[model samples]
Target: MVEFAALTYGLLASVILSAAQRNSKMARPHPPLLLYLGYLLCGLSAGAALGLGYIILTRFIGH
Candidate 1:
């Protein structure tokens, strides 16, 4: 599932770049930009999971 999302985003980024390269109006993005965004998203998800786990553990421990 993760691989699919990563590959999908990567392909989308490539398509966007190719289209922009063919036209003059599209501002060229910084190279390798969207990949960083995807990675950040994955990290955020992991962080969220960690936070949730901590909350659950603390609740259980308090009882």
Candidate 2:
């Protein structure tokens, strides 16, 4: 369940961040594919952090 939740959260984060990135650069024209990948990387990192935090919190609280 934790794994599933992590992936779902990661994907959601990626999409939302990507869209925001795209919109933010409308005046400067669209970015290249590599930039999008970078945004995805950022989102995945955030999700990993969130997942790890959740795990630690649950472990201590459930104890």
Candidate 3:
């Protein structure tokens, strides 16, 4: 479940980041490839944290 959540969040983050890049009107310089990778990594981390939190909450709540 954690792996699936991570992948889903990573894909969503990448898509949103790429779309933001495309839609921005500022004269910003092109970002490096690593920047996109970092974005995906951040999303995965977020998903992991969320999944863990859910697990902890469920355990305490007797779900």
Candidate 4:
């Protein structure tokens, strides 16, 4: 369950992040490495948050 939640949320976050980046009208381009790192961090954070929430919910519900 944790793995499922993590992967799902991580993928979702990455997709959204990429889409936002593509649609943004910035004067200067960001470095590729920086963008990659941002995506990585965002995905990991979102995954971890969802995974933790799932764990807590399960515990509270006594599943």
Those runs of model 1 whose alpha carbons end farther than 4 Å from true positions after fitting are 1-31
How do the residues 1-63 of candidate 3 rate in per-residue lDDT, one tens digit apiece? 979976887787777677567646565654666468657777767987999999999899975
Give the residue spans of candidate 2 off by over 4 A. Answer: 1-31
For this target, which candidate reaches the highest TM-score against the unseen true structure?
4
Q: Count clashes in each candidate, considering only residues at least 3 apart in sequence or on different chains.
A: 0, 0, 0, 0
Lowest-sum lDDT 10-residue window in model 1: 22-31
Each model's TM-score? 0.49, 0.49, 0.47, 0.54
Question: How well does model 4 score by local distance difference test?
Answer: 0.75
What stretches of model 4 exceed 4 Å from their correct place?
1-26
Which RMSD values do the candidates have, in order?
Answer: 8.3, 8.1, 8.3, 8.9
Indicate whether candidate 2 or candidate 3 has the larger lDDT: 2
State the lDDT of candidate 2 residue by residue for 2-62, as single tens digits.
Answer: 8997798778777766766777777554457646766777877898799989999999988
Mind giving the per-residue lDDT tens digits that candidate 1 earns over 1-63?
A: 989986976776576556556553556554566557546656766987999899999999878
> Between which residue pairs do clashes occur in model 2?
none
Which one wins by lDDT: 1 or 4? 4
Candidate 1 at residue 3, lDDT? Answer: 100
Write down the lDDT of every candidate, Cα atoms only: 0.69, 0.75, 0.74, 0.75
Error (Å) of candidate 2 at residue 47 is 0.4
Model 4 residue 56 distance off true place after TM-score fit, in angstroms:
0.5
Q: Give the clashing pairs for model 3.
A: none
